[model samples]
Target: MPTITLSVKDENFAGKVLQEVLIGFHSETVTIRDIIEARVLQEVEAYNQKQPQYFNGLVQPADAEKTVNGYQLRNKVVIDPEKQVYVALDAFQKNGFFVLVDTLQCSSLNDKVRLHADTRISFIKLTPLVGG
Candidate 1:
């Protein structure tokens, strides 16, 4: 199976995830559920840490109720500073041979974060077929 690797500005966290998984952070062996969970948790933590005052009363609100770069955090998806980085498989699809390429060709999967060089992060959806 093809592997999809997620790289961040800092490699420290990347190394930690690899150590915990006992496999390449971007390997196909990782499950999609694990990847999404890690990403969600990391984002939530980062947001809360940056704005502790705002999150003091709200714990996993239905919606973040705030817009970050026009993307309203409806699901309370914030960055978690404590968990600086996360590594997991892309579970959007069931196929295990294909991989989600984080490049201009895959613009639909590319989010606004791709445009920002300051916060460089990307995720590839590994699938059974090369083209999903």
Candidate 2:
């Protein structure tokens, strides 16, 4: 079993550390999409287990708003995990965010790459200018 650290960051490069996940690799390579899906699924499971009334996901959960800490606590866990994953992948494809594997930028979901014990994966979310 190999483990990887998943992190989310903003434009200024500040990051939020996510949990490390143990993954099984058939060999020494896996697709980017596979990695993303695994991450999203793990997040969803954690959120579900915590049983938060609201779900704090890669993006804001539906019908929920951010709090002072920027997390939404909903009274009902009513969001689709699969849909959330799809939205994230779509966002990646549209440049809504970027993936950095071990400090190297990954450009495609289908791109295959090798994993290492110390590999740190970062999701850098880009924000758009209000006036632009």
The numbered model that scores best in TM-score is: 2
Structural similarity to truth (TM-score) of each candidate: 0.31, 0.73
Scored by lDDT, model 2 comes in at 0.62
1-132: candidate 2 lDDT, tens digit per residue: 444443433333665664234444444577778777776676677777776654444555565666645446445564567876787788778887787888788999999878766666676767421100
Among all candidates shown, the one with the greatest lDDT: 2
Give the residue spans of candidate 1 off by over 4 A. Answer: 1-5, 8-28, 52-61, 66-132
> Against the correct fold, how does model 2 do in TM-score?
0.73
Provide the overall lDDT of each model, using Cα atoms, as 2-decimal numbers: 0.31, 0.62
Count clashing residue pairs per candidate.
20, 2
Give model 2's clash tally. Answer: 2
lDDT assessment of candidate 1: 0.31
Candidate 1 residue-wise lDDT, 1-132, digit = tens: 324435422123232221111112434433434434444454455556664433321112333443332223434444432332221123233332122223322232222222221222333323211110
